[model samples]
Target: MVTIDQANQDFAQKVQSMDGGETLMLCFQCGTCTASCPSGRLTAYKTRKLIRKAQLGLEDEVLSSPDLWMCTTCYSCMERCPRGVEIVDIITLLRNLAVEKGVMSAPHKKVGEMLVKFGATVPLNSEYEDKREALGLARKPANTLGDEKALADVKKILKATGFEDLVGGN
Candidate 1:
């Protein structure tokens, strides 16, 4: 049911040109990646099918798929690939492309927002602080937790990458 106009003829080429995406065209649809995917066992995420879609230039379908975000990035598929395709990396690249287009799930947006505001995805909550203190560690790890300079640097990078705007963060 796919129409010709829906395909981006240069999609695969563009993927190949990106770092960590060089091995994309080497995929032969052996299904090894899909078979080895732990996420596929639980979710409807079929790595092989996604690769085929990319090969066939189904750009919109591939990028906008909710299944794209289901990968746990465990590298199980990459380890098992007979063709040595960087499946996880390709997924990451696709995710970046999707984000560039401002297509992202709510949870991912929330995480990005948290990163923008707090400079960390897991903010310094009381539960985490208590656990750290109990373990003889500083309540806030010496990272970007409450460090204004570090947080500002993170915001600068996010702003430079246009991620702050993508996630609706100031």
Candidate 2:
């Protein structure tokens, strides 16, 4: 019962509109990206597989795959790509698409929530502050946590970018 109508024609076009997606179709499944991926070494992430899914325009599979967010955006794959494909950027675009579809994993959501609430993905703690002071560094380092204004601005930027809603931030 398979038919040509099953193809996701718009998926590639939609992804192409994003920054790194432009070179998506150039991938020939050389496995270079996967071979260069450090994350793929320790995790279930497979860069080549993701590129293949994207090339095939498997929108649902690409968007829902937890592997979409496994990319560290290191650009190692892009650098190693013989075809000069922007693999990291495409992965980032995939993450954005997944968020748009409200399919973020719990760890991603928690990190986003922490960023919105504390202006840092990893909130500063008194224990860490003590360690800093012990090391002759200021207990409160120069960052968003040290300045309420900076923290507010970070929240404002997140709101302006619509990332708050994307991460289900309250």
In terms of lDDT, the best-performing candidate is 1
lDDT of each: 0.90, 0.85
Model 2 per-residue lDDT tens digits across residues 44-111? 99999888878777888889888987887888888999988888888888888887787888888899
TM-score of 2: 0.87
Give residue 56's error in model 2 in angstroms: 1.2
Q: Among these predicted structures, which one has the highest TM-score?
A: 1
> What is the Å distance of residue 143 in model 1 from its true position?
0.9
Candidate 1 ranges with C-alpha deviation above 4 Å: 3-5
| Pairs of residues clashing in candidate 1 | none
The collision pairs in model 2 are none
Task: Go through the candidates in order and give the clash count of each.
Answer: 0, 0
Residue-wise C-alpha lDDT for candidate 1, range 1-170, written one tens digit per residue = 77768999999999999998999999998999888888999999899999889888999999999988988889999999999899999999999999877788788889889999899998899998999999999888877895788888988999998888889975
